[model samples]
Target: MAGTLKVGLIGCGNVVDYGHRPALLALKDVELVALADITPARRLIGKAWFRLRERQLYADYRQLLALPEVEAVVVAVPQKFRPRIVLDAFAAGKHVLSEKPLSNVPAVAAQLVAAARHSGLQLAMTHNYHFLPEYQKLKQLLSQGLIGAVRVLTLHFLGVIDYPGAAEYQADWRHTLAAGGGVLMDMIHAVYLAEWLAGAPAQQVMAFVDALQYAGREPVIEDLALLQIAFPRAYAAIHMGWGAGVGGLDISGSDGHIRLRYKQHQSGGFNQPIELYSVDSDWRRSDHAIPNLDTHEANIARSFTQLWADFRDAIREGRAPIAPAAAGARALEIVLGAYASAVCGRVISLPLAAADPVYQKGIAGIAELEAWAGSKTKAAGLFGLRA
Candidate 1:
């Protein structure tokens, strides 16, 4: 709390470039002291990016964890590989800042949360979307009752860019079964945002999961996810996919409505926001100006920096970060619930039962659940279901 925070980084993946790299470099009180990657090329890339000595680089993350200098670590590996590393970090007596989706399996995610809770160490999520300029402005307006109590929220991320992972590892790992669900799981920022904006945990979910982008390629995942989530007093519809489609945010409140559109209709975080406005009950429109309307990349970089600062202060002040591991676990369950809704053609309840197959095994559980004969998810051959 009094001095700089020494941090270690695991997995030198592409996310580190725009997200963690800037934060580690920009935050004066945070220092990225050690780097670890299974790939030599990625290790070299991280070494150059962080300017670490050869001794500070490691092929095995355990070696980095053994370093007593590291007070915390940022785990940037794929979801499937995150649990062990995070659990190990807790065992090593270090706080952890894990990448999104926490883990591919709900059971594993719960274990990680329990581990962090037992260790009394900080376990924050890389849910930097909470700090994005547009979303921050949106939250502020909603909090001020600019449109009265929210009744319905819609987030369109159909234009999500399908960026590949580090070439050193499997570049298209996101397209594989091990990555979990698909577009919905990949862009889980929208899922948690729905909960945060609604001011309540999700109560139920219904969805249509398909693979329009890779339909004929024998795809194992869905590129398209249309979800309808129900909260106690509000509902949210999230339309997401992997190709160029609609992109924006719309909110309907008791007194008015709010809208946000991105430049060139690209998804948020991919392009700058071009317009944000609200309409009152009288049909009068009031435009809101987004501060620091810099390049989308710059805004993303800043969000991560702010998130890192929050993680640092949370550890020092003995509090939870803006996005904690429990939030990540909840978000993951929401996505998995959407998948189950698609497969079963029914509204799946929230905080899925521990005995539920989806709760036990993530996307893989889809194959075990009773499938609806006419379900589009099954028709599309997603989750190992045959047409």
Candidate 2:
């Protein structure tokens, strides 16, 4: 807590170029001690970015984990390869900061959370959207009773940019079913934000998930997902897609309503927000100024920086990080549930039953469920559902 925190990084992918690199460079109390990536080019890129010596770079992440100076590590690999590394980190007595969606399978994600709890090591999620200035202000207003009791929260991210993975790896991995689900799974940010804003865990979820953009190609994953989720006392609807479409946030509360519009109708991380305002019961409109009004790129960098700081402080104070592993697990279940709902045409419950195939195998288990004749996901050939 007093001195610097030494950290190692795994998976030197494209996310490091924008998301984590700036944070590691900006946080004075955190040092990037080592980096690991299977791809040599990516490892070299990280070496140059972090100014790490050849000895500090590794092809096997286990070597980086072996370092005694690394008190913590950030796991930035794809969801499929993360479980083992994270488990190994906890076993090695190192705190872990994991990227989103925890794991492709809900059961596996739960196991990671349990492992972290049993090890008494931190397992924080990179739900950095919580630290974004717009979302932070939105949470502030909601907590201050600006919207009274939240009734319905809608997040529109239809214009998500389809950025590819590192060229050294599978660039089109996201378009495959192996990536888990699709755009919604890739951007699980809206899912966690829904729970955080609703102030409870999701109870039930149903969705219409389809590959509208790649429908003609018989895509293995969905490009558009419309989900309706039920919390204890509030509801949230998330509209997500990978193509050009609407993008913004709208909240309808008992006392008032709030709306956020991004510039150029781009998604949250793509462009700066141009408008944010609220309306009261009396139809009085009030505009809220965004705190960090720099370029969207700078805002995103700041969010990651704050997230790393929170991770550091949480470790020092023996407290939970702003985004904990439990939240990520729940979000993963919500997404897997949504995919199940699309395939089976039924609302899926939370903390899915242990006996449920989807709970055990994630999107891979959708084929085990009875499919509806009219299910759009089935029609679109997503999640192994045949028309």
Candidate 3:
């Protein structure tokens, strides 16, 4: 607790190996003290990769949480399992940095937020995109009035799930309603980025969803979800999908506009470019490509490291967490509202109450819904056999 903050890590999935482990290791102020994983194979991989001693391994996260030296926890568990682990960490008197999308349901997310607040522990959400240098520079420019009163924001985020040939690979727990999968939850990075750049919470939202390309897959969750949000001084639109396409954002303001495009490769690399246009000189344009900076994966690791550094500083100062618990919950609310709007065929407003039909029915005790989704999916020939 004095020189290096002892860190306990939960979950040893691909994200932990690629992102969290490297990030935590890079920070001099932090030490990876303990790790927990349900899978022995994963725990072994983490232990071997990080050179952790055998005594630091645990199959149950509660044991890790009980470590007196652990001042904080980095929760990299799957989205569905996060809420419980986060709450437990707080109850054990440890701060938390949870992976994105918060949890599978808004109700569960709310409980996590409440627990963090009550325990007076910092709760930060990993929204690495917001910490990208280009994004920060852009935000600084906008705050300096370079764009002069924003008016509109638009984004297109689409990707293909390279899930071999198994139905479970594509329509597994993550895609089920109970697990809070589908386009809305899986592709919500755009929603978080938009709200952050727009500098305001979405006041109202309207959405349209459909089972566009993956009709053969089971589970009625939509493959495409188009969302529109009306903010106080700006309006925003997002097109999310699971098809083979990619695009980025275009923000138009009274005086200028900014554009970005992202390309993902099967070879595990990415190309991204950000451009700016100003109306002052007949809409003159200037653009720059984000340097790959040693593989896109490394860039993500660096970003995550920066994110955790900010969280550490916030915890030390007794200030708000880098990405506060409320912000994480609010992001979930926006995604849930979008889904509710699509299902109910109407616009949905913010600050949803516990009595809202969507909250009561759509997200309430999702295990039942997951089971139903699994059955419906299996019956619908999601396993790739035609009935």
Candidate 4:
């Protein structure tokens, strides 16, 4: 709590390797004091990346939490196992920053919210889209009523997991349905960002999800998703896929509209400017200078720099983080709600009741996938599969 906040990382996975390390290094007030990973190879990889001493390496995160030096923790592990680790960190009296989706299941996510509130510790979620410069500009414009009375928003993302040689899907947990896999997992940022830009929670959703291209290799998880979300006094459509094409957003308001463009750089791609356009009366169109934030790397680490700064400040001030667990929870609701609607061929309402199965257990709780979208999910339980 004093000089650089001593931080421990719980998962030495891809996001940690590429994103968290860079963000932590970029923050003057934060220190990467120690790291814990289950995989020995991953632990060594992190040590080599951060030049961590042997004493700084840990296989069990609990041991890292036991250390008095660590003041904060970043839960970058898979969504399924994160609830336990996050709870443990709070129990250890450390503040926490968790990866997106909160958890694959909502019940577990609820537990985290309860624990963090009772523990009186800040639990920040990595809903970092709001930090991007372009998004910031758009938010500013809307706040000024540049695009008055936002009525609808449509976000589009098209492209396969364009990792060179398909690296993202190759032997990755993201390819597994039970792990909260596919476009929803990969692009839940869009859901959260939509809410941020729209200024309201989705009231209902109807969607279609399928694995259009990866039928042979990874047949269970969905790669293509088209979701329609209904908001009070507004509407939103989000389409993302592991297919191919251009992607962006078109937001229409009573006065005008805003268009945004972005690309997901797969392999070591640097930051790219986000192009935004504004249209006004008399068919007047405004050409805008590019925004500086890079969309290519959220999970890769670039965007989290601001996210970390906010988290650090919030922890110090005894205030709520910029992006809290509630935002993440809403995104999960829209996501799992989409899955439920797609499965049942019915328009699923949002902020689902506690008794709704998907509200409690995520996509695995859906009982009729074969009837509507017909996804080939082989999920066995909350945590395991038949693999």
Please report the candidate that would top lDDT against the real structure.
Answer: 1
Q: Is candidate 3 or candidate 4 better by lDDT?
A: 4
Candidate 1 per-residue lDDT over residues 101-189, each given as its tens digit: 89988888999999999999999999999999999999999999999999999999999999999988899999899899778888999
Clashes of each: 0, 0, 0, 4
Better of 1 and 2 by lDDT: 1
Q: Which stretches of candidate 3 lie over 4 Å from their true place?
A: 160-171, 263-270, 274-281, 288-294, 360-387
Residue-level lDDT of model 2, residues 123-231, one tens digit each, is 9999999988899999999999998999999999999988999898789888787789789999999999999999999999999998888767768888899999999
Candidate 2 TM-score, C-alpha based: 0.98
Encode model 4's per-residue lDDT on 302-364: one tens digit a residue. 568888989998988888987888888888888888777666678988887788877777766
Lowest summed lDDT over 10 consecutive residues: which window, candidate 4?
A: 378-387
Off by over 4 Å in 4: 160-170, 263-274, 293-302, 368-387
Error of 3 at 148 (Å): 0.9
Return the TM-score for each candidate structure: 0.99, 0.98, 0.87, 0.89
Q: Would you list the C-alpha lDDT of every candidate in the order shown? A: 0.93, 0.92, 0.72, 0.76
Question: Lowest-lDDT window of 10 residues in candidate 3?
Answer: 365-374
